[model samples]
Target: MDHDVVLAVDIGGTKISAGLVGADGQVHRQSEVATPATRPLLEEAMRGLLTSVADGASPRAIGLASAGPVDPPRGRVSPVNITAWRDFPLLDLVGAIMPGVPSVLVGDGIAAALGEHWLGAGRGVEAMLGIVVSTGVGGGLVLNGEAYAGPSGNAGHIGHVVADPAGPLCSCGATGCVEAYASGPSMVRWAQSQGWTGPDARALSADAARGDAVALAAFDRGAQALARGIAATAALCDLDRVVIGGGVSAAGEVLFAPLRKHLDGFLTLGYVRRLTVVPFELGRSAGLLGAARSALPTAQFESPTPA
Candidate 1:
């Protein structure tokens, strides 16, 4: 018999990916396309992708994972990178594509965290934070083995956590946000300001790996800011682990080494000090799988630890 699956879609600034996923987090079919610059084209692409991936198979449900800022309850999204979509009716599109199928909408950050909690590095952890550090930093929470999307579906926005009172301005019009320092663009911009000319975060990461002083320093600064953000989130939530991903995270030890060093200094409390940080295991697949998990009618991640 064919495996029962949900239609899972992950919509991002650059790409729109769709997959048919089973309850066990296995993807049976998948496809992706570049996100169009216009809303009409985007809608058309999404419709075609969904239809192709589904292949006439009626999904048990639908899971839509969208980049924030998202209104999950209302199935609307306004991703900063995707300027064409402001308060876009994403779920309505899903509904129109597959009428009568139950659907769940979640922020991409939340989906990443839920994916990690369900099957990735956070599998056994009771409370954890999953963060994405790229052109922008985003985060989501899994508390007591349950995804906590909060009232606005923006609960674990750790990127906005303040790291310094006198730091650079963030895209969110705030000063000293972790994103102002740790995001890929922020790191590259800071490196450039210091006379370290690199094309992008990828180049910076390469140079940092080669022991270039300026590149290393950039990573160090970004790492410190990320450490502060992680520590703050851990303290506030009493977290057990943190899973980091996105483009900047691929810097590996260039980022992780400094982050670990700085995190130790910030996490002084005994409980908080025990917080462990790890790389995201599922990578890009996390969002799709997490969305599928959300669509599961009775899905719940029961913690091995006692409540």
Candidate 2:
């Protein structure tokens, strides 16, 4: 059967979203559900989700965007939040569901970066980084008009980059990682430790918006850590722009103002100093769009096109 669209799936710790996307990157039909807890349930959920969007039309290819760490060369994934899966053969499972269609997988950060570069905030930029700052800090890169996932598909993991050797311990067992300070939970934890009694990142943002001193201080600290990571990345990759998104990024100036301020101080190199940081325009749909883009034959990095 000749196919007119691609099946794009974005799998995160909290939710799984699937959609039928055309070559133009428009999502025709989409649906999502909360992530299942166990491997069996998760598999079942994915099958059902894909089946729903692919009801009648034949998909040219299946593209998956999953939370890291992932092995794209092996078509496997083991996201930190989804403890039920470890080296899960996600590509094989998608192949099983749709027999002959080609399927490709990429890290969520890579997908977001590629998607932003294609049609969002970083469009037309020569080199850029896309960042997600929610539960954890995540990043990906687009260089010279191409998405670079590296050989291991873990190239742009800026969150794991050390920001302060003496800072807090990270979930990955690293000390003072960008994630340790800039993640939503990290910022909240710092505020709480400082006697700012916020229940969550949302509350912390609200407090900061109201000019609460401790909450503001918490964001400042997180911003400084994030700035350190961003500066390093920009310097190393010669990035021209950065697009930041995710739940915490919605805090508006509560995050960007301090981030830009700290970034300005950290970026002393002339080439890296001109890097423009902007908010993502695609909101939560960047991953889905990027997955779809990856499936397209014209994508800079893609598998063999099906006939």
lDDT tens digits by residue: candidate 1, 1-307: 0337788998877678999987677899999999899999999999999989988676778888888889987889998768899999998988898788788998888998999898899998889999988767888999998999999998898888899979988887789999899988889999999999889999999999999999999999999999998998899999999999887899899999999999989999999988999999998888888888878863232322112
- For candidate 2, the per-residue lDDT at 262 reads 96
Query: RMSD (Cα, Å) of candidate 1?
Result: 3.8
Candidate 1 regions with alpha-carbon error over 4 angstroms:
1-3, 298-307
In model 2, the Cα lDDT at residue 258 comes to 99
| Model 1, C-alpha of 77: deviation from truth (Å) | 0.9
- Model 2: number of backbone collisions: 0
> Which pairs clash inside model 1?
none
Q: Whole-model Cα lDDT per candidate?
A: 0.87, 0.88
